[model samples]
Target: MGKKEKSYALGVDVGGSHITVGVVDLVSRTIDQKRLERHPVDSKGSLTEILEAWAGAIEPFCQHEVLSTVQIGIAMPGPFDYDAGISFIDSTQDKYESLYRKNVKDLLAKKLGVSNAQVRFKNDAACFLQGEVFAGIAKGYKRAIGMTLGTGAGTAYYHGTEAHDAARWGEEYGDSIAEEYFSTRWFAKKYQEATGKELSGVRELVDMKEESWVQAIFKEFGQNLGKFLVKFASEENAEIIVLGGSIAHSSALFLPETEQVLSRSLPGVPIKKSILGEESALIGAASCWYEA
Candidate 1:
C-alpha cells in the first residue's frame, strides 16, 4: 500500500501583540516546526487590520491541496465567547479593543475563503494546559493544573479527558488579585519598590540574578506562588502542576523556593516547566478538532 495519508489541522495562538500559527499532525499530536509562522499584530489597530494579519498567517497552509479543507483551531485570550466565536476583549484590557463583541470566527473565515464552521476557539490558558496534558509534561497524570506566567497570569485545570479555563486570574490573594502576585508585573513592581529603579521584566531580573536583592525577590515570588498553588491545587486535587509562559522560562530562579513551599503542604505533587513552550498552545489548539 502507498504510505498512509497524514491528517493535519491549523493551530493558531493569538497573543497580545502577535500571532503564531503552525500545522499540527493529528496522529502524532505534534506541530510541524518547519511550517510554523509568527506575525506581529497591532492589537490597537482597526478591526480590519487585525483580521487581515491573522488571516494572512493562516492562508499559506490552506494553499496546499492536502490542507485545503484543514480545520482551524485558535487559542485566544479571554473574555471571549468561545462557543459562539465572538470576541469580548474591550478597551479595559489595552489590547484588541477594536474586537469588542466582534465575530472573529466569521470575519477570519471570510478573509481566508473558508466556512465559519471550519474555525474554532479555546481559551489560551486552557489550551496551554490541554497541550501539556495531551502530549507534554502532564501526559500521564489524571488531574493537572497548568499556569502561564507572563505580562499576566493564566490558569487551567485538566480533568483526565480534557482541560478548561480555571479563570482564577481575578481570585483574591493578599492585597490584590492572583494576577498581580503571580505575573511578570509583580517582579517589576517589587524590584522598582526595592531599588528605586525600573526594570523591564523577568529577563532583566534573570541577568541580575547575582544581586542579593534579585535573589530575594525570586524567592519571595516563589513563596507567594507556592502559597497560591496550595489552595488552587488542593481545590482541584491536581495530581501534577505544569507551568509555561515567559516567566516560566526563568524557572530556575524561583522554582526551588516554589518547590520548598509546596513540599510543606502539597508534597509529592510535581511541578514541571513546559517542554513545548510556544508550541504547546499550537498543538493544544489543533487538538480541539482532533479530539472532537
Candidate 2:
C-alpha cells in the first residue's frame, strides 16, 4: 500500500496592524514553523491596496508545490459576517475602513487564483480560543474560556470542537464595556494619573517595576481582570480560562492579583497563560477545516 498523503491548510490571521500566514497540519493540529510568514498591512490603505497586500502575503503558500492542495482558513477581526465572508468594519476606525462591506473571501480567492468555496473564515477571538483548546493550554478542558488582552480585550468560550464569544450580560464597568477597563489604554491612563508622566504602553509600565506606581497599576489591573473573569465564569460556567496576546507577557506582574480576586468567589477554576503565544490563532484557523 502507498503512504497516506499529508493534508495541510493555510492559516491566516488578519489583525489591525499585521497579517500572518502559515501552513498547518490538519491532523496534527500543528503549524509548519518554517513556512510561517508575516507582512505589515497599511490599515488605512484603499480597498484594492489592502486586498492586494493580503493576497500577496498569502500567494506564496498557495503556489508552493508541496502545499498546492492546501485549503485556506482566515481568522478575521469582526464585526463581520463569517458565513458570508463580508466585512462590516466602519470608517470610524482607521484600519480596514476601505474593506467595509467587501466580500473578502471572494476577493482573496480570486487573487490567489482559487475558488471562493475553498476558503473559510472565523472570528479572530473564536480562533484564538479554539486554537488553545485544540492544542494549547486548554486542550483537555470541557468548558474553557480565553482572553487576548492588547489594544482591546478579546474573549471567547469553548466547548467540544468549537469556540464562541461570551454573550453580553448587561454588566458594565465605569459605564463602558468590559474591554474598556481590561485593555492597554486602561493601564496607560492609570499610569499617567499616578506618576503625572506619559508612558507608551503596558510594556513600559512593566519595565519600571521598581516604581511604586507601576506596581500599583498592575495590581489594580489584576483585580479588574479578576472581576471580569468572575463575570464570565458565572455566566459561562467555564472550567478553565486561558490568557493570550502581547500583554500576557507581563503575567508575573498581574497574575497574582488576578488570582487573588478569583479566589474570593471561585477558587476551583484554573487560570492559565497561553503557551502557543502568537501561533494560537494560526493553528486555530487551520482547525476550522480539520475539525469541521
lDDT per residue as tens, model 2, 1-292: 1234446788899988889999888777788989999999999999888998999999888877444455888988878898898999898656898889989888888888888877899988888998898888898889988888888778899877699865332258757877778788788788778878787888898789998877888898899889889888877888998998889999999999999899898899989999888899988888887733
Candidate 2 residues lying further than 4 Å off, grouped into runs, are 1-6, 65-68, 167-171
Cα error, candidate 2, residue 273 (Å): 0.3
- TM-scores for every predicted model: 0.96, 0.94
What TM-score should be assigned to candidate 1? 0.96
lDDT of 1: 0.90
lDDT of 1 by residue, 1-292 (tens): 1244336788899999999999898778888878999999999999999998998888988887444466888999999999899999989889998999999899988899888988999999999998888779988899999999998899999987878999999999999999999987898799889988887778988998999988999999999999999899999999999999999988999999999989999998989999999999988998887743
Clashes of each: 0, 0
TM-score of model 2 relative to the true fold?
Answer: 0.94
Off by over 4 Å in 1: 1-6, 66-68
